[model samples]
Structures are given as structure tokens and as C-alpha cells.
Target: MKLKMHISKIKCINDLTIELPIERGLYAITGQNGSGKSTIVASASRVFFNLPMKEYFGDTVDGAMIEFELDGNKRSWHKKGKSWLQKQTGSMNIRGFYEGSLIYGYRFKDTTYEKLKKSESIDKAKLRPSHEFIRKNLGLILQGDEDYYEKLYEVPREYAKFDSSIFFYEKNGIQVSQFHMSTGENLLLSILNSLYIKNKERKNASKQCIIFLDEIELALHPSSLKRLVAFLEDMARQYDYAIYFSTHSIELISGIKPDNIFYIERYNDGTIGVNNPCYPAYATKFLYDHSGYDNVLLVEDDLAKSIVTRILRKEKLLNSRLVHVLPCGGFRNIIKLADDVTRNNLLGKRASICIIVDKDVKEQAIKYKKENGLASSCGMNFLPIESLEKYLRMSLVYNVDQKLFKRLSDYVFQQRSLQELIAEYRKLKEFDTDKNGKVLYSLLDTELRNRRTDRAELIDLIVEYLFEENKQPIQDIKKFLHKELE
Candidate 1:
């Protein structure tokens, strides 16, 4: 059985729709954060599977309408709420409408009984339905339900007459104990469980099953992610099961078969839309350019791309044909993009990635890079949001000492510039009650005796200080650079 979903009339959306191909491959949902990608999935689940929207999403201004295709027939479902569910003052309504002669009288209310009857016939007569039958044969693994906490040590088998589990990696630590027996053992165990279930169902059944994984990159190491994707693809072929997932990771999409990939975008009005890049017109153009690129450069956001591009051009590294600087939009995209590129041979062995994220993401970014064997690139760089001033100073080759750095950081936090900061310091110095302002002035005066370096190097030092601290070997040099250059 295959399921295709289309959404409309949801909150913040005027007319957003998506079509999920029910083929034996993976489908990824991707977009920027707060773009309503998750809303689309949640809406679909609520309508088609009769799942509660409140459990996953709060009440919003509007309800959703979903259209689905099962077997060769089409059906539609509608959902509406009086107020956002979180307000705890509204009621939600979900109703189904069926189309086509085969299911003319069928409706959502009758589906349970209909499924029971169908299953009874199959079980009693020991007869097999056609492999393409719609309702009774599919399986699902939601984002956070992969591992059964109660079992603790057992993996669940697919099509085992048990409810499907949705696993959310960000909320639940990766269970690695059953696999690597290490820190992320819980995570590894979850992955193994998913694979084990898929294999078990394949061995027992003649019909194909569909698996939907939302945010598939969560809690997965790069190597583990790579392996999981490959295994899913192989399972699609060997077991005839179809896989669909959503991610913001650009790396996860790179180099995959165009026929298997789908792109999603949401509008400000809250509507969602889908794009199939493999369609003849779209595929042809991207295919040509896809071969022309080698390495991918990921940025934190679109603005970062613009800023970094200017800096790279200034540094004369922007002209290289071997490197391509593309805006991935966020850290998740960076990780996904890296995973996809490394797994695909189409990108080639020489392909490398550079990720430039903010200092706030330094911890997660460094962990991802190190786990993925990407720490050696010098390509993964973190720049503090507050260090833009440091960049401005370095652009003039002005040495920024530790005292200056601290002062600048404080100034930036206060939304002031260096000159403004100096002026304010002077004004406070006149009062001189505690002499804190004068002390700051004296510190800055003494620290400004060193030679200045490039802005990029200065930004790197600030990031290292905030994130890597004593763990990084350059801490001493970074301090020396700041003290001597200022």
C-alpha cells in the first residue's frame, strides 16, 4: 500500500499543498527553520491516521485540509480548531470524505470496521491480497518512537501487530548500548531497531511497506547516518518498501538519485509547497550543474553567505573552481549536506566541505565535525556574532588586545561601536567615583601596543576562546595574538 498526501487550509497558509510519491525510495522534506515543514507532517498524520494534532502541535488560528491517495483511490480529510490547542479552550474536528467508485460510500468513520473485516477475511481464509492493496499493509516509524523504553534491550519487529513508534532523537538520547555499547549506544540501538524491523517485515510479507522518518539526521553520527541512508535505499530495492523522511540537511540531499528527491518550501502566509527536482525540466538543468561542482561551503544563514563570500574574495580564496560556497541556512543543514556528499560517489573523493556557523553553535558544530572525520578541514569555522567589530578592527589591521576585545564585546552587546564605547568610557572617567571606567581605559591603553593581524584570524581566535577554550592548542597563540597585536 502507498500513501500520498496534500495539505491545504492550515494556519498561516492560504493554499499550501504537497504530493508524496508512494514509490520504493526515500523522500525528504526540507526548508528553513520556522518555515512550517513540521506542521505539514503533523497535519498529514492527524488527518490520514486519525492521530491527535494537540499531542504534537498547539492550537492555531486555522485548521487543515488534507487529500490522500490510497491504492488507486483518492480521499480527503478536513481538520479545524476554534482556537490554538495550547489555549485549552477549543475543540478540533476531523472528518474524511472519499472519492472514486471503489470507495464511494467509504468514509473515515467506517475505516476501522472496514479494516477489521478485511483483516478477518485474510486471516480466516489464509488468502493473500494483491501486493498493491492500500489500507492493511503499510508500516510507519515516526520521528521519536523507534525505541521502546520499557523493553530496554529488545528491538521491535515490523508488522508485528504492535503500534508504530515515533522516535525523536533530540528529545531522546541516542540509544547506542545495544550496538556500540558506548555513550551514544542508545542512539545506535534505535537505528539498529529500525533496520531490524524493516528486515523482519520484509522477510515475512509479500507486500511492500512505507516508512516515514521525520528529521532523519537527528542524533545520528555522520558515518552512522551514511550507513542508515544506504541501508534504507538497499531495503527499498530488496524488500520493496518505500521510505520517506524530512530534513533541513542539504548534505543529505546531495548526490542522491534525482528521481527519489523532493524539495519543500513554505511561504510567509503559512502555505507549504513541494518541488520535484527530478521532473524532466527541473532535473535536466540541475543535472548539468551538479556535475560541475566539487566541494560545498555551508553558511549559518543567507546573510552569512554574503558576508563570508566578501571575506573570501578579500582573502583571494573565492575564485577556486574546486570549492562551491552555498548557503545551507543552518547547522542542521550543514550536517545533512556533509552526510549526503560524503555518502555519494557522484561528488567524488576529493570533495570537501566548509561550514561557517555562529559561535553560539560552536559546541554542536565542533562535535558534528569531529564525529564525521571533518575536524581536519580547517574548513569548519565559527565566528562570534559579537566579533563583527573584531572583524572591523582587523580589516584596518588594528591590533585588538584582550582588554580591547572584552571592551568591544561589551560594546557590541550594548549595541554600540568602538568610538561610542571610547566616548562613553571618557565620560564615565570624568566622574571617576569607582575608577572602573579609568581602569578600563588604562587596560586598553596598555594592550594596544601589539601588531595587528587579519580580521578572519581575529574572529577565529574569539570563536576558539569561547568554544574550544583549553582544548584547542592555539589558545596561547590566540591570547598572545590578542595581547601583542592590540
Candidate 2:
């Protein structure tokens, strides 16, 4: 089952809709602070568990409503003068879904430890085994405790024993409970324990489970946050769980797939918008990140960056003091970063942003601009050729001087002519046709490495020769660089 939520007139978010697969995977909700991340989670919690709306959104719930879709069926809860009217329910396994928990503000403390110590609820003999997942992963979050073992401690109530008394022990039997544990340790243990207890109660392990964790990365080190994310990803896959976490951590976003990320933005019009499958760079709060460069050029990949760098170096603009060329991984990502930086003036008065993509994507860029109303003045432009790889290959096969060709023959072809190597390379059944020519680039790198030659230097040399042959586009880009620099 998948879930789609449409929220209207809720707190800072005037209107927003987010759809995500709920069967099994990790999903991230990311944005700048105060972009109504908590409100989205609260709304889902209210819909799924019947939690109160006033708990998240206070007295100003005048015309607020949330419409939800499970699979293709729709149901809505509309606010009517402090009361809510529920519509027809969807064909959902409410009991199966409700078995999962919504954990918000996951900050654990020693208060539980104090209660355990004061009360006579400790059940020493009725010990359950510590979760292997938690035991193996806890060390990754806590420093200098890689060899530590987790001890499951239970506190007995009148009817049953609660899994609240968690403890840890070192190799020498040095034990530490939640009272003595660090905040990160306490948080990790509490979360794992809660999940373990809940999941154990499930009658069917294959049933879809949904877990919502809001502000999931609070009060943890970046390294610990990364480890926790890895754990969640594994659990989500292994248990057929859909884990949705609302976070502002770039660390969290770095590990998540772009398609799984949803970026929430508060527009100037006082309404909220969602950018699903958002590029990680676009979701990053670069407005306040303070990149030291005065000007930045966003490109599709490292090859694009290399091409831009070669041109800038030739124009005397390659100095890191004046410009920084960064590869944003893909065409869409570079486009998103360009849009985000331009609209927000993210670098402010101290810096400027330019986007340069390969000419192969010129058509896509044109289509994107026509569809999205992206201004031409946003500084988006294309490289002179389809791509640097194709250009370099053309130069290598046809345009290089005999002296350079002889060097290539000696190093890349084992002293054979380029023709012979080309014939052999083309005969391979699975010739890579990747637009960026990644496989060709790797082959070139390996060949140069075998001959004890620097691949980058050879590429730079090829780019230099190509510049002499292609001056018009080079000059045009130089002018673009000059304008951005100023």
C-alpha cells in the first residue's frame, strides 16, 4: 500500500500534497526549518492513529482539512468549528498499519533510569536477549565502545514486564544503564526497543508496516546519524516496512535516494510547496552555508566540471579565488540547484551562480525552461559540444597531431596505431553508449595508468588542442564567465 496526503490550511502550510510508497522503503521529508515538517507528520499521525490535531496545530484551525489516499481510495477529515468530520474510509488494513508507531521528537533521557532504580520493577531473571541489530549497530553510534554488548533490561509492571530498563556492558563487565548512557545511546536503544516490541507482536511478518519518525536526527553526531540511517534502510528492506522520517540533516539526505526525498518549501506567497524526488543539493540550505567562493558554476558531472575548468583556466578565470566549478551529478540536479540558488539568491551579495550543462541536454533544458518558466537570466547555458567525452574521443581519433597520436599509440595502444585499437574497441558486443561516456573514460584512465601516464594531464592536453580548433564557443563561454565573475 502507498500513501498520499493532501493538507490544506494547516499552520504554515496553506496547501501541500505528498505521495509516497508505504509498502517497503525509506522516505525522507527535508527542507529548511519552519517549513511545516512537523505539521505533515502530525497530520499523518492524526489520520492514522486518531491523535489530536490541536496537539500539533493550536487554536487557529479554522478551515483546516486533510485528505488522504491509500492506494486509489480517498478519505478526508475536515474541520468544522473545533470538530472534525470523517468521510468514507478507504480499503486499508487499519489494524495492520496501526501496529506501527509514530515516534516524534525522539529525545530519550535518564528519567526512565531514575524510575527503574527507585521502583522494584526490575525483572533480573526474566531477561530477553538483546536485539542483534541494536547490539551490532550501537557501537557505531557510540565512540570507544565498538566491543560493547547490549543487555536487555526489563521492568515489571503488575501484568507484564516492560522493555524499559535498557543497559549496556563492556568486555570487563562494566555496565551502564540509560542513566549513565549518552544522549545518542539512550535514543538509539529506546527506538530499537520500541520497534522490537511492536514488531514481535505482528501476526504476519510480511504485512506492510508503516513507521513515522519526525525530527529523527536531533541531538546526534553526523557519523551517528549516518549509521542510524543505514540501520533504518536495512530494517525497512528486511521487514517490508515503510519508514518515513522528517529531517533537516544533510547527512541523512546524502544516504537517501533522490526519488525518496521530498523537499518542502515555504513560498513567498505564504503557501507551502513540495518538490518530490528533490535533488539533495537543491534541498540543502546553501543560503546560510557560506561557501567561500565569490562565484560558483554548477555542472552535470565531473567531466563537465573538467571541461569548464579547462576553459576557465585558459581564460585566466579558473582561480579558486574567483570561481568554483562543482559537478552536481546529473542534468536534473544541476538544473534544480540552479533554480534554487537563483530564486533564493542563496549566495547573497557575496557571490553569484551559473549553470553550465552539456550541449546534449540543450533540448531538455529548453523544454524545462518552457515548462517551468525558468528565466533565461538565471545564467543557464550549455557547453560547446554534446559532451566533453565525445569531443575528446573525436579529437583523439581524428584531430590530434601525429606527435600526440604517436604518444597515444605508444601509451594507450601498446605502440599500435589508433585505428587498430578503435577496431578492437568497436568489436566488443556491449559497447557502452552512455551519454557521458563513463565506460570510455574509465578505459582511457586504465590505459594511461598502465603506461604510467597521468590521465588528467592527457585530458587537459586534448582539451587544449580542442580549444584551438573550437574558438567561437570557447570565446562565448569566456564572455559568460567574465560576466558572472563581475
Candidate 3:
């Protein structure tokens, strides 16, 4: 059975709704920090598992409602409450209604004291949140040593204990009940758990299950993340399970299929807006048409996907409408993807294509470019992940706006690491940090205030300048050759 969720009147969200595919695969929920990404997950947990809404979210006047479909029938839950005065004046009512049937309803007066008085009474609660139930069934793995190597001799119903159980590892060490493990160990354990736990469930279940992971990119090395994605995709197909994970990592976005991709954005009012890449008619067509092409633009791992798409559209070399600007987690994946494209004929006629990789990946980019025929031809363009830095060092150094370019140039010279550069940028007046803490976005008001030229036009001019002075245009070179000779 697939679960669909529609929420209304929740905290920081007025009318937020999203339908999740319960197909046995991964579902990724990603957005800027505090964009209510976690809220969606929390709300779903509350409705599905029958938990106290007040426990997760503090007091609120507006009641929340969730509607979901179960077993081909629609069901809805509504929670209404007034603020309690002195822990005695108000009540919270939970009503479950399904297909004209009033399944259940309960009212709790003075919940604060009631919760404190009977905190151990689990039976009083009508529905347990799905997350809590899963955790309980699976056994809670806390942030320490007890969680690591913790084995369950008996399997919970709807869940089976595997020889290799799900474990959480951190940078410090394996979080065994009380002891911590090394980052490498933690990463290895996470990879193992991600696959092993899912596999075990698939082996035991009569029906397929879905695995949802939040911020899956955390603590994972790029190579490991890539391997995990590939493994997850295969496992989903083999076991008839679906896997969905959210990440701020661009590398994962570009490497995966567009049909499986979903974007979450936050509105000013605190509600989240979901953009499913598969749902968009045009995007769906594009993905279906170009499933194998590897010659792709790989932008910075931390860059906002919207900005990258806008930049590509401005260049006019490729229309963002048709060409997908995939975020390949980072420079490492860019190289990996490019190499894969060249060696594998997955793209057919579109096989030999160029990828815009970061200059920071100089060694790998150059080596790959030299080794492959596709990489040799205008198929590779290495530039710094920072456009300002690239503009300052490469040709047309003076053509760019002096102040903006100089600021980035100075930053590049002063900051030795990308992390340090981003950190310093955040300290500057113009740059603002997004929820993810990884993307440092320039304030549009501040950026435009000092700029005289249209930024998009300036970018195009820069591209034109590079093409004229640095190398021949690939399109022109293609036109000069006659395919009839072949």
C-alpha cells in the first residue's frame, strides 16, 4: 500500500501538501534548512503512527489536518486544540475519519500534566507515529557505543533482525552504546547498514517496502556515496523496494535519474513547496529522451541548483529547458561521470560530450581529458568552482566588474581551502548562508545595487569572450566537418 500525505494548518505551514510514492524505493526530502523539511517528516510520523502532535511541535492555535490513502481508500485525521492556560484550561482532540466512517476521536484536557503524570502509559495514545513505532520495533540506536554492535535476537513483526543490524557510526568512532568510532568506520558501517538492512527486509517481507533517508550525503566520502547510490538503484530494482533520500549534495542529483528526483523549496511564509522532477511534463519528457547522455555540466557541489540552471539558460549555448544541469555532488563525481560517459556508449550519438569540471580538480580533469577522445575535444572545460575567481585568473581578466571580481580574487588568494573561502564569504556583508549551511548565496539586492550591467548578459559576454580567445566553438567545428564522408 502506498501512503499519500496532505497537511493543513501546521506550524510555520498553512497549507502544505505532498504525495509520497510508497513504491519500494528511496524518497528524498531536501530543502534549505528550516524550510520545514523535517516538519514534513515529523508530521507524517505523527499522523501515521498516532503520536501526540504537541510532543513534536510546541503549543499552537491553528489545528493540523492530514489526509492519506491506504489500501485504495482515503482516510483523514484532524487534530484541534486551544492553548492551555496554566496547564489546565485547554484540550486537544484527535479525530480519525475514513470514508464517511468516524473511526475514532479522543480529547485530552490539560495534556501537559497528563503527559508528565502518565509518561509511561503508552496504551493511552490511540496511534503511535510511524517513526517511533519503527524505531521501537527496530530498537532505538542512539548516538553512542550501545547502538553499535547491538544485536536483536528476536525480530519484531513487520521487521526482521539481520545478522548485520543497522548501525550508526560517526567521525570520532563507531557509536557503540557509549564508545565512538572513526569517521571511516562510521562511513563503512553506514554503507553496510543502508544496504544490509534493506536487503534483510526484502528477504523477509511478502510485500515490498520503501526506505526514506534524510541527508544521506552526511559523513559519506564521494566515492562511497556514488557506490551507495548505484547499489541502492540496483537493490530497488532487484528487491522491488523503493529508496528515496534527500541531500544538499549536487553529485548525487546529476548521477541519478530525473524521474526519481524531487526538489523542495521554502516560501517566505515557512511552508515547503515540492517540485517533483518527474511530475513536470517537460522535465519528464527530457529525462525519458536523454536517459543515457553523460556529457553534462557539473557545477559546484554546494551551488544552488536554480542558479546553475539559470546560468546555463543565460549562456544560450544550451537551453535549460532541454539540457539538464545536473548537480554531480562535486568535482570528483564530475570526473567520474565524464569518464563513464566516454568509456560507456550509454549516450549513443551524444557520447562524445564536454563537461564543465572545477579547476580545483586539475589533475584528475586533465588526466581524464588526455585519456579519452571525447574528453580531448572541447569535451572538457576546467574552471574554478568560483566564477569570479575563474574570471579573474583566465582571459578577459579586466572585462569583468572590477569590485566583484577583485573581491573573489582576493578571497581566493587569502583562503587556502574551499571551506575557509565559504566561511569567509559568509562573514562578508553581501553573502548570506542558506539553511543547508553549505551554499553561500549573494543577496540579490546587494549584488544588483552596485552592478551596472545585467548579470546574465555579463555572463554571456564572458562566455563569448572565452570562446573567441581560448578555443574554437564546438558547434562551428561540427559544422565544418562533413558527416557524408563517413
Q: What C-alpha lDDT do the candidate models reach, one value each?
A: 0.45, 0.65, 0.44
Candidates 1 and 2, the one with greater lDDT: 2
Q: Rank the candidates by TM-score, best first.
A: 2, 3, 1
Q: Which sections of candidate 2 miss by over 4 Å?
A: 56-63, 85-88, 94-129, 144-146, 149-152, 156-181, 198-203, 287-295, 300-352, 357-380, 383-486
In order of appearance, the predictions have TM-scores of 0.39, 0.62, 0.39
Model 2 lDDT per residue over 386-438, tens place? 66566555555446456556655655556445666556555655455534454
Instruction: Flag regions of model 3 displaced more than 4 Å.
Output: 45-52, 58-62, 82-178, 182-201, 268-271, 278-486
User: What order do candidates take by lDDT, descending?
Assistant: 2, 1, 3
Alpha carbon lDDT at 107, candidate 3: 15
State the lDDT at 277 in candidate 1.
Answer: 37
lDDT (Cα, tens digit) per residue for candidate 1, span 363-416 = 887787678665343356664442233333342223445554564455332333
What clash count does candidate 3 reach?
Answer: 38
Clashing pairs in 2: none
* TM-score, structure 2 vs. true: 0.62
Q: lDDT, candidate 1, residue 176? A: 25
